[model samples]
Target: MDIRWITAFLDFEPAAHERATAFWSAVTGYAVSEPRGEHAEFATLIPPNGDAYLRVQRQEEGPSRIHLDLHVDDVRRHADRAISLGATELVACDYVTLRSPGGLEFCFVTHPGESAPPMTQWDGGLASAASQLCIDVPASRWDAERDFWGGVLGVPIEYAGGSYAQTPPSADRPMHLVLQRLDDDPPTVGAHLDFETNARDDEAARHQELGATVLDTGPEWTVLRDPAGLPYCICGPDCR
Candidate 1:
């Protein structure tokens, strides 16, 4: 894919729409763009500093999840290549909606941009950036899904032990795209937001105070569920 930009969309159903929007807007300190789309269900979190890469979409009904959009120069050209790499086409319009082999939904669309948003600095000196999208793939589909993503993105795939792999951060590439092979099937392929922060504990606490619930804690990250029940993580030890 000749990716020019990327955006991660957080999805929620009608009932949780307002809460999801508010929590994320507060967390990222970005102003929300007016909802667009035919159903008035799309909005962007316009970052104060750099290019915007975060958005929210309201689904009629479904569990809250995140999906990625690859903005390329030629939508059809890149999308055709994506299909050749085993991405199943789900819908097509001005953009192509497709699912990777493991099933995480994504789209190929045209948008013009280069720089990604910079790390947000808070008043207390805590800094962080919504810098990654972690896709959860089933163990059985790991090989195919991993190859599919790497093939389509045309980025070097780096491994972290046996469980995690990621497309290393590139200055002009959008967000860090990661793949996590799960032990068993998860019913569907899904993704979660990952934010890198200098102060993990404090950052997690900040989210908790703003309506997110702590889900679990790990050696390198803290898992949390926003009010919409969408699981996201706060990573630490580095702000990159």
Candidate 2:
């Protein structure tokens, strides 16, 4: 099962879908496709050139969160491989949804010839380029989660710090998968999108202008909430 494509999906509530779509389009410099699906809940964020790597979906239930879509040559084979590596199957339909060892949910879908979008360049010395899907793992599940993703994706896990591990991007696959070990008493597991920027403050300000709020800030990254209340991050220059 070859991992042919990776997509970062922004799941939003129905009431907030429009706002979320508009905000993300402005931030990433992409155009949103017409809504598809039975309830018109699914849409793609299309880049001016190249294939789309981002999508938006209106959730029928639960709060907004980020999830990944792995497009593979064989969905069933990929799902089986993931399950054998400790992922629990959640659904098996047109696509297969599985929860990783660290608790982050992702899906295996048929390849649609999608490819990573090229990084956009912004003016004002605000270089907000490249996007990353970060997997938040509990400290206890960190090692297993890292190993699971590395094996499933056929990528090497590169340790950045005591708690940070990431799979470097290759020419064929441009998206990155980062595993971050949390320090919470009972660590929480989830996924979030991260934007690499040369000017964090300026880029964050731009996002604020587009209706996103800064939830928190650290030495290297700033946490933000979209109009739909989904949390994402803006990491500093070192992000890759």
lDDT against the true structure, each candidate? 0.85, 0.83
The segments of candidate 1 whose C-alpha lies over 4 angstroms from its true place after superposition are 237-240
Cα-based lDDT at residue 174, candidate 2? 51
lDDT of 2 by residue, 1-240 (tens): 267888888999878888888999999898999989999899998888778888999999888888899988788988998999989999999899998877778999985555555667787646665478888887777778788998788778888886788887655665677888888624447888898888889899999999999999998889998999888899886687
By summed lDDT, which 10 consecutive residues of candidate 1 come out lowest?
167-176
**Local accuracy of candidate 1 as per-residue lDDT tens digits, 1-240:** 357777899988789999899999999889999999999999999988788899999999887888899988788888888899988899998999998877788998887566677788897999887888888988888888888888899886678776899876768754777888988887777898888889999999898899999989988889999889998999984523
Q: After superposing candidate 2, which stretches have Cα over 4 Å from the reference?
A: 112-115, 185-188
Q: How well does candidate 1 match the true structure in TM-score terms?
A: 0.95
lDDT of 1 at 213: 93
Best by lDDT: 1
